[model samples]
Target: MALRFAILGAARIAKPALIDPLSENPDASLVAIGASTRERALEYAMTHAIPNAGTYEEVIARDDVDVVYIALPPAGHCEWSLKALEAGKHVFLEKPATVNEAEARVLVDAAKKAGKRLIEAFHYRWHPLFRRAVEIVQSGQLGELVSAEAEFSVPIVRNAREFRWQASQGGGALADLGCYPVSWLRQLTGAEPEVTSAHQDLEPDGIDRRTTAHFSFPNGLQADVICDMDPEGGRKPPRLELVGTKGRLDIDNPLAPQYGAELKLTLDGQETRETFPRRPTFAYQFDGIVDAIQSGQPVWTEGADLIANAAAMAAIRRVAATG
Candidate 1:
């Protein structure tokens, strides 16, 4: 049976992220749309060819819906995710899974109690490129991993009003862009690292516009993550570099593989570049979720993983606040 999905909000990311993927996938079907207001919901439903439109409660209560794709602000993610699970529906939650680790734990517990899946929508992780990178690192070709660094930055054209800029809504460079590099480092290291230091550039409103964090792993490995929402120049290519005793690997545009990506391995004084097909990251993400629901396959971003990422983010934020 196709996974019947209902969107919880009319977020801008819904189209390229969730709606288009569901439309392209035969195993998934968009059934309904629920927004903060009925008018907004109906507008989105008509625009997206979704059959049902209503309030979030009404949509989640529908017996025909199998899953809920939550695109709400970070502040509302924890509450609505619990509500969806309580409604006996699986959740495809957007990143930063929750504002904090405590909320993440509550959501994870609720999903377990409801016997439903809660996947953090780290779409990049679903792509084969990342998996291949992990394979190369773990294949012993790189030898013992020494250190890793990942960065994501985009120039701020102007100060604009958005949910991402609101502290109450969980808006900050650390929460928005930092999560990706942090998660990527964790994936490469295969172990959660402790935050050793963190620094941030804050706006007048006290929200961080840029952040740099340092982490130390148990195996004497170290990693650095840099995220900047307001860069001076044009958008910097998202990159991850891992250094081992034997060689080093560098990946370009690790965040959005849909545009294009290249992974270069430098070993034995030779450089080799690997490129992946230009498939949207969200498509892979949707397919993975569908497979997990139908075939009992493990989700890449499971509940425990979500909690760990949230905990790491919390630690980073605490360190940033200190100095």
Candidate 2:
């Protein structure tokens, strides 16, 4: 039987985030889609060739839906995910899972109570490029990890109607872009971070356009992240650099290896460069989701890690709230 999904919200991000990947995953199917209005839902389903379209609640209540893909903005993620799980369907949630950690906790607990599987859609994590990076860190090739830095920057979306410009909608450079680096750092170290300082540039309505924050881990590892989507910031590809007692590693475009990624390691006066398959990261993720559901294996971005990541992001916001 195919793993079926019912998506909430006619979100544009869902197309590349899932639909394209779903096209390649034979074990899974995008059976339905829901939007603010039935008309909009029907239009999106028609364009995508998905069979069912309706209001969000209507889709969740469908007996044939095996999973709920919460494709709404960050603000609605927790609420809808909880409802979906409560209805006995698994949940595939978008990033920045909630407005804050407290919200994520509620959603997490609800899933536990419902005895349903839940996963945060950190699509890049399943890619071999990222997997190799994590392995290098764990293999002690970098030796007694010292410090790390991650940066993701893109041109500011100038559209007045863009949801990311609205603070209430949880739109910001940090939430949309920075979360990747935060999750990356936390996952690599398996340690929660202490936000030492944070700074952000905001739009007119107080939405953050650019943010940079420093963090320190329990193991004495120091890390910093910068996510910029402001007018002054130009397109900067995703990159990560790590230094250790013995050597250091640098990764270019870890965000999406298929778009082209390069990894360089320098150890004891010698350096080496490596690359991975250019498969779409989403295909790995979409198929991984289906496998996790059918085989009941654990996924990388599930359980307490979701709340831990939320806590880290929330901590950064608390500190950034100061200046």
- Model 2 stretches with alpha carbons more than 4 Å out: 231-233
lDDT score of model 2? 0.89
- Native-to-model Cα distance after best TM-score fit, residue 308 in candidate 1, in Å: 0.7
Each model's lDDT comes to 0.89, 0.89
- Angstrom error at residue 173, model 1: 0.4
Candidate 2, residue 63: lDDT: 95
Residue 262 lDDT, candidate 1, scale 0-100: 97
User: Lowest-scoring 10 consecutive residues by lDDT in candidate 2?
Assistant: 228-237
How does model 2 score by TM-score? 0.97
TM-score of decoy 1? 0.97
Q: Give per-residue CA lDDT, model 1, range 31-140, as digits (tens).
A: 89999999999998888888999999999999999999999989999989999999999998998899999999999999999989999999999898998898998798
Query: Candidate 2: lDDT of 165?
Result: 73
lDDT of 2 by residue, 137-243 (tens): 98988888889999988875678667777788888999999999999898788789999999988778888889999999888889999998863546888999999
